[model samples]
Target: MEPSVFTRIVRGELPAAKVYEDEHTIAFMDAGQVNPGHVIVATKRQVETVMELDDELAAAVFRTAARVARAVDRAYQPEGITLLQANKPAGWQTVPHFHIHVLPRHEDDGVTLGWPRKNPTLEELSVLARRIEVKD
Candidate 1:
């Protein structure tokens, strides 16, 4: 597969306004900020989706995102905050790399995070849950 935009950034081929960095992850200001303080925290490894992340890498990514979110809260003082992560295009993920979006929110930020809600029957939900259940 072709390299993702984020992969290019990680390889030092593309420039980014990076905010935070560690051995396993990097947090950078998003080029398209929904709000001024919107940022993206991405794993250093080129994991394509959340399911591909091992526990350690996943925890590292979230740890960086949490730290960045707290700092954004202090600096921007927005009314609220939003943490978004997408797995596939169907899940609203444009980039193929695994990353987390930290957005500072206000009442009229012009961002709509709504999706159609579905009401499933108990039997339906139970069946689906069992199908995806993880076992030790």
Candidate 2:
């Protein structure tokens, strides 16, 4: 399969403002950032979504994300951080390859995640928790 743009960046085929890179993944600053210190962590593989990521790979990517988030926190010291990884187009995933965005958030940054809170009943929460527990 042809490598993705992110994979090319990982393989050193393309130049990036690289912050970190490893055998499995790479982290760099976003070219068109919504805020300052916006970083992207991507896998060397061309997995299109988080669901396609294997457990070990997912964990590694998240670990890289956490490290980059900590750095963003130290350098930018924004109000908070937003870790976002969209899937398909329905999930606002523009890139076909999988990647996580470590957005350094500030007050009124206009990068709303739009995750509305749902006050589920206790029974619903219990059922959902049980379902998740069953997966382990």
Model 1, 5: alpha-carbon shift in Å? 1.6
Stretches off by above 4 angstroms in model 1 are none
Candidate with maximal lDDT? 1
CA error at residue 112 for candidate 2, angstroms: 1.5
- What tens-digit string does per-residue lDDT give for candidate 2 at 1-136? 6677887887778889998888778899899899999999999788999878889899999999999999999999999999998999999998889999999999988876667899999999999888764332
Alpha-carbon lDDT, every model: 0.92, 0.89
Estimated TM-score per prediction?
A: 0.92, 0.85
Q: TM-score for model 2? A: 0.85
lDDT of candidate 1 over 80-111, digit per residue (tens): 99999998899988999999999999998788
